[model samples]
Target: MGALDYVLAGVAAVFLGPEMFSLFGLPVSLALAMVVLGFLTGILVGATPGLGGPMAMAISLPILISLFGYSADALLPVMGFLIGVMKGATVGGAVPAILFNTPGTADAFMTTLDGYPMTQRGQARKALKVAHVSSAAGDTFSDIVLIVCAPFLAIMIERFLDLPEKTALLLLSLSFIATVVGGSAGKGLIATGLGLLAAFVGTGEDFYPRLSFGTEALSQGFGPAAVFLGVLIVGELFRGIEDLWREKARSGQVTQYDLSGDQSLGWADLRRLAPHIGRSALIGTAIGALPGIGSSLAATLGYTVAKARHKPGAGDPKMGEGAPEGVAATEAANSAVSGANLIPVLSLGIPGNVAAVFLILAAESIGGFTPGPSVFRFTETAVNPELVIAFGLFTMMMLANLMNWTVGGVFMRSLGFLVRVPRQLLLPVVLLLTLTSIYVETPRFEVILFTLGFGVLGYLMRRVGMSPLPFVIAYILGGRLEETARQAFAATGADPFFLFNRPVALALMVLALLVIVWSVRPKGEAS
Candidate 1:
């Protein structure tokens, strides 16, 4: 089939909403089932503190590998599950915040400002419904934007960028991501440097076993899957377990809130919140497109803007005092990040957030689907399989959105009783899952040890308030960055410093330096 034919076929499949169709011996129904399963699991996890989308993706990626093996067929179901988790987690986070005044995730902290107050006023159902609506709308909006833009962006890069420009752009991305994310710019860079160093070890031509330190086991570098899961999931599990153990004795029973009275939101309320949802969705899409800047900032900025612009009706209260629009603004903003986070991942192979990192990991591990400009290289002779898979992911995302829209309200409202599962109970299961998942991928005990070591490092990074986002990102991009730089260098065998003569590469270098300088500059210092 032609490339255009494949594109059109993928689009038709999406709109047709095929349930029983199978491709490459894999059924779309299975993918849909995974979407449902992952969404529910995400809701469960996200409603529980210390569990989020990364944990879900980390645990599931290897299991998916074990189930499906390394094949192109694995993409749809794996991506479906991951997308479901991302959306579900973002929406589910609002439940605990409103019901217990404890945010289910970091991004939902701001949601507590209004959500908890609404619960106190016996509007728990109202608050949850608002969260559901806005979250669905925001996610759908961001996803549509991603589907429209990512392929075009990739094609543009493929058309315009030479090796030197691509290499310089990657370097610029690394610098930008490092500085923009995490608690401290310096710490972010340090983490990124650690990742680059780790990734460079044992896997290059110059040194077949670079930094292997004479160990036979180190002859083969660590898999990106192990490193990512170990640092993000295993380490996080350990911390959560420690916290759970310490608090288990002090924490008796979770205080249950009464779900009584005035829970119904009128059509007028929806009308009032629609504009805020749309606006917050746009804000979040923009923020999420940028690497490293997370949903927490998006939610905060969304709520702040809504507050500044809010002129509530006579009966309606101001934000932070239980305004339903507050719920819409915060939830819409955070949830929108789920879909838009994939924008960078699809176009540049740079994951914008924790969930996207694993999506890249899954694609890489499954093989044949490398995300970058090359993925979107369209020609009359050959079909771009990745492009079609991108559409499949889009279809999965839409399925998840549909699920969220149809059942999200009921699920959130019912979660009051369902979320009684304690961290103490869940932590052990997650630990087991982590070990089993990693062992499935690599049967070696040493790999487990290496993973644990990375886990420990990740724990320490978290302890020091350093974000691991930059670390994982750099690790994932390190090989590609190196490859591109070498290609650029070889292309300019005449002069080692050839980027100086390349206008695009030079412009990117200048921009990167400016960004670093601006990032390092004192906030109070005059320019």
Candidate 2:
């Protein structure tokens, strides 16, 4: 595996060799360019009210695939870009949430609770700056966790786990995700079950395709990218456009803000937030490590915990009034989760969220890399002294953050001007970009059709009380769960009790059952 890792790295370097050169006595390596691009992309995606990191990645993947070709060298920049989007979007959500009382993403909803109030009081600059700094701090801290814990966790799994245990571990991971995410125990279980079912929609082993609906495309494995784009990106775009139209019909003017004030924070303000940063970072990292939990939940949880932990008469001026600490806590927690989410994906090959699942898919499509313990082995071989690759990844993320903070800040501050552009002009530009990007990836009209179809489904789901998170999560984990179950069954000659024979598997099954029961029990009865 180590040798294979080196070979892959070598191949990546070779493919990217032409792009590497010296400029101003600094190594302008291909990796460096990718990192910068990742950062820029993040800023662009984050600053937009409706756009998000995942959507940005979806749009970029196709373009990158066509331009760079499918190789690790090509893939690394895209990964860097995703990292940038993650960091940028974490903070960027605050913009619309604070100014217009519209959350760009669910995670930023908490921010708007107080943030918009501050804006109404003409403290928009202060709120924006606090949100930005706090987000950066949280994201940086989470990256530190990734740097420290990923290798250790990977080694533990690689050294100790057998197939049964690994399978059990993945099941346990899924259980934890469902428990933490769905809020109620029953809903989580139901959601997980639903996710598993969704994952089974395409072809499986045994030369049987389970739920293809007699379509030829169904006989082949479905494209994960297509599904993600359709359900998440396209759906959101349509919804955004519809909302824009509604806003137009109701009010002749789109929301606008004033950011001319000097709202920069001093060292004293930062010092006040230092304590909360530490706590929020921990919360975020822990939540991120768990499967199914997303950054938005982490942000809300961080805010709640921060409020709870406030000292009597600490008189945090920002509490409920959009205090800087509120921004810091939520931002840190949400941003930290980004790095933490990657831990499970890189170390154990289990995706913690929809973005991570897409990352795994992209890695497979471009680099032929299967994420898990084996990734470490192969990376060690391909890049040698695996630390270099790790360091490279870390460097890329750091660079992305730096770029995001500096460039993104300016862009956000200037957003008041950009939003001034007529909706008539802006909407068309956005639509064109979306259509062009979609076409570049699939080049099939059917892909666009599916995208629109899923977009409507997404809109409808939102209209109902259902969250799209569970559906997306289910879609991602579906295939893996089935494969593991099948493998377990085959190893035991299809014996129903075989899964129970193994202690680890038995334990997981018991725990999952207990969770299901506990989740369904009357709320007050158990708690």
Candidate 3:
């Protein structure tokens, strides 16, 4: 096909979508339906404290593959649902943080600092509105950038970056992630190393599996779906249940509340928050482009910047005490990350955060698409199906943003009744669902045990103040990194110092070294 033909085809793929059904005499694609479902599900998940975007994605991944089939044609609809969940979850997370004193997701922790205080002062509705607007606007901005940048960056990487450079870039990404993903670089490095070790088991081209230790299941390798669900979702679920027990023991019943807050937000309110939202969106977009760094940092940095620069308006609540701008600032930054997190995933096959890790899993499980520069290649001889899926996923995110604008307020308000649901009741249901989802993916009981082992490891890691993110991301990238490094070595004739053969590779390694040093540097030394 010609360029125009491809463009038209891509546009059609995006709008028409796959998995169609009739809706009142109109044919509606499941991709479109998923946008709505995913957004509503996001609200449900994000309004509840134990769930997050990754957990939603994890639970849906195997089920989506089963429904859509492991064909290239299934890519669009599955990806569409995933992208929708991502956008919706980011927006919905602020709801609980505003309505109750609890944050629904890790990234929403900052929102609670200002949001719950607003609730205490009878501005709960206003806080929710600010959060909703900022989240939608910021998400839209980031999605636009993803639309423009993902393709361009993919093309650039394809054209100029050879295997050596790619390998080095991957290394740099890992180095940066290990250093900067969370506090205590030593712990981060340890977690990442453990991930790499775990991922290597039963996975390789060699006749003898790298780390399987002679077990049949280990030799076969654990699927990403199993590992991530174990580490991210199940692990968090375990912790959440423990937390619920503690909460139940501490306070059997919680205080009830009436919605007495001023729910109205005027145009003046929008004007007031416009600057903070804009600044944080841009900041979040930039951060999202980098590999491994996550929305929590984006939210924190945005809140920090807003606090430093903001001057309280006369008779207006201060930013920290209960300011609506504080909600906007926090939400916008975290929401902006929803799109930007895809940049590396779409362009270089590097997942930027936990959510992006599931996106990779979805793409892999559904088949027909691989997330990398190759996926973006324009082949005139044949149709590039992955590109079409990419466009379709992009469309799904926009639809989600539109949903956030239209029905999000009603949904958040509706969930006000659920803000105080007993966690003791809630967590058991989540655990059962998680177990069922995993069983659906693999009928084997041992797989469940293996996953539980990882979950226990994850829980202990968190209990000891270590971040699980680095471990998850590192595990996902480890085998790929090894494969690329081997390719580069083979290309350079098996030299031990093969990376030194390319100046670009050498420079990238140096950069990685510098970033590791900077990330691990002591706070006292810096001061």
Candidate 4:
């Protein structure tokens, strides 16, 4: 098929595929319906304290899989829902931060800096509008980059990279991720090692499970649902519960702000904010294209740069002191990361953030799709279903963006009351819901225990300032790394020094070493 044909096929797949039901003589594709549903759900969760996209994704994945089964047909709807959640959550997370100074995630904390001050000044609605506009604009820009760049990058990698080179590339990715993710390179490496260890427990070409210790449950290893939800969701729940217990005596009431004044985001306002949004969008997109560096850093950098550039005239508010540009800069940069983060996942099969990780998990679980260079292959003789799916996914993202531009602001503004929901009351309910969902899927009591164990471990790791991101990424990619290394070794006829024999592979490995060295160096000593 031709390129145009492939594009058309993908568009058709999303708009004309399986129907949830007819909507007034028009067919509403299940994927489209799921996107809408997930978008709304995402906003709800993101507006609430102590919940965000990853948490929502983790809780919903098992249920979606159970409902859809493991078929190629399930891919679009399941992934579409996830994509919606990602976009909606990006927009929705600013609500509480702007209204009540409570950030649902680390990135949103940057939004809260200026956003809450706007609330104090009775311009809360104006701040929300700024956030919504900047976020949607940044996201739209990032998606455009993803659509244009991922295929070309994948094609280049496919054409140029051999197995040993691929193996080295994976090593470089891991090294970079380990170095950049957490507080210290050493701790990140430790987290990565633990992840690799956990991933290899029951996996390999061995006759018996490698680390099973003769237990049947161990032989099967850990389920993805258990490990992912445990570390990402349940672990956070543990932390929240502990916080709630410690702060139980504190007042639960939130200061309510009246929506008043010039809250409209007009054309002149858009033009004024466009420069900040554009700069942050570029910054965020660049950061997102790399594996493992997440949106929080992007938000921080965006806010810092905007603050530096912002010059307040007499009688005007300074940046971070109720300036709308602060909310715009932070929101745009962080939201932009969501779309561009998919670049690594689509092109290299490497997830860049937690949301991308779940998307990878969904594709892996469904069995028909595998994300990587080959997925973008173009052939005249046969249709590339993966390419079609890629375009379909892109369509869903654009659809979500459309929703964001049209109605997301209204939805987000309405969620101001969510700030009043006490964390003490909310955390346990979320905990119960997460545990129940996991149990329903696994149907084994032991998996729950294992999940709680991992959750405890996650909580401990967080307390020590060790990020769980490296661990999760390492766990997902470990098997693939081993498989690629094995392939490289065999292809080189058992050559022990095969990597060194290939200049590209050798260079990549050296680069990986340098990255670790650079990362481990003292901040004062480094350039």
The parts of candidate 4 lying over 4 Å away from their true place are 525-527
Candidate 1 lowest-lDDT run of ten: 11-20
Per the 3 Å backbone cut-off, how many clashing residue pairs does candidate 3 have? 0
lDDT of 3 by residue, 10-64 (tens): 6677567664778788778767877687778877777776677778888887788
Can you write out model 4's per-residue Cα lDDT over 1-527, one digit (the tens) per residue? 88788888888999998999998999999999999989988898899888889889888988899989888889999999999999999999999899889899999999998999998998998999999999999999999999999999999999999999999999999999999997689998999999899899987897999899989889988887788888888888998899888988988777777877788889988887889999999999999998889999999999999999988779878997899899999999999999999999999999999999899988988887899999989888988899999989989999999999998989988988887777788788888888888998789998898899889988998989899999899988899999999999999999998777899999999999999999977797421
The digit string of per-residue lDDT tens for model 2 on 1-527 reads 45445445544442343456777876666666766666656655565666677877777777777877886556565666566666666667677777777676788888887777777767788887877777777787788888677777887888876556666776776666666564565455565665566567666765668787777666654456656666666667767777777777665456555555457778987887788888888999999987677887788889998888765356445466767677778877887898888888878877887678667767766765666666555342244333334445666676766765677666665554332345455545655676677778767776666566666766765555344565666677667666766776777788777657888678877886776565566675522
lDDT of 1 at 428: 84
**lDDT of candidates 1 onward, in order:** 0.83, 0.68, 0.82, 0.90
Of 1 and 3, the candidate ranking higher by TM-score:
3
Q: Of 2 and 4, which scores higher on lDDT?
A: 4
User: Number of clashing residue pairs in every model?
Assistant: 0, 15, 0, 0
Residue 111, candidate 2: C-alpha displacement in angstroms: 2.2
lDDT of 4: 0.90
lDDT of 2: 0.68
| Residue-level lDDT tens digits of model 1 in 296-415 | 999999999999989978887799998888889999999888888888888888888988888888888888788777777666666667777777777778888889989866876677
For each candidate in turn, give its C-alpha RMSD to the true structure in angstroms: 3.0, 4.1, 2.0, 1.4
